[model samples]
Target: MDTIGHHYIVEAAGCDPNVIGDANKIREIFLEAAKRGNMEVKASYFFKFSPMGVSGVVIVAESHISVHTWPEKGYAALDVYTCGENADPEKAVDYILEQFKAQYAHVSEIKRGIEEEDRTFTHTILTWEERLDRRNGKP
Candidate 1:
């Protein structure tokens, strides 16, 4: 099977710190992104820090979408990963970025698991006698 993952970094210059500190707002943004990306969310959880910040994850049938916020720094990070072809992680990332409304952001994406160039191939030439020897090794 083919697998793909999108990891992103959000750098904010002029964002409301209070918004990032709210767990409910962060969760809402993530759930909306998941819907726009066509991900089937199986479970979800969020945690509010002692004094600031919010962290949460939405477990989806395709894989998962997660987010973490830093109100003090006006920054947030996200990871959207999936194992199948039906989900569009990039769309999710874009939507989340827009929600953040950061003055500036540096975003990136990568393909995870089963990359073609990273694969290895083996070729063997064998006769009937060699094939018999191979079977012996299997046992």
Candidate 2:
């Protein structure tokens, strides 16, 4: 079996308008979501825009979580990417939606991996050539 990477995209609509413009609140939401997903957040940064918006990224060991909020539109877009066992990006998405009191959310999940048969002789030949060149000190 091939190793796989999981990625998630989450969009929330009809979120509380007040929450969108606050950088501190947005940070709280992200931290809470990371905790709920059992993800370790190493660092984060957020910026607040006047007239109502916030944007931020949380650096997590598994990968990262990012969000942008629009208060006027009552909408938020989020991306959660993780590449290892015990990382559930879906849970993080759910936590954010619930925290923002979103009326509805759109979620997408994609699994990334090379198909077994798709890794044919051509791929192997290229890999072998690269290895041989590296071993022979041929740039």
RMSD of each: 18.3, 16.3
As a TM-score, model 1 comes out at 0.73
After TM-score superposition, the amount by which residue 32's alpha carbon in candidate 2 deviates from its true location, in angstroms, is 1.5
* Total backbone clashes of candidate 1, pairs 3 or more residues apart or in separate chains: 0
Q: Which candidate is the best by lDDT?
A: 2
lDDT of each: 0.66, 0.72
Instruction: Please identify model 1 stretches exceeding 4 Å from their true place.
Output: 4-14, 115-139
User: Which residue ranges in model 2 land beyond 4 Å of their true spot?
Assistant: 1-3, 113-139
How many Å off is the CA of 68 in candidate 1? 1.6
What is the per-residue lDDT of model 1 for residues 46-67, given as tens digits with 9 covering 90 to 100?
Answer: 9999888888999998588877
Question: 62-104, model 2: which lDDT tens digit per residue?
Answer: 4889988998887888788776787777788767776677776
**Where does candidate 2 clash, by residue pair?**
none
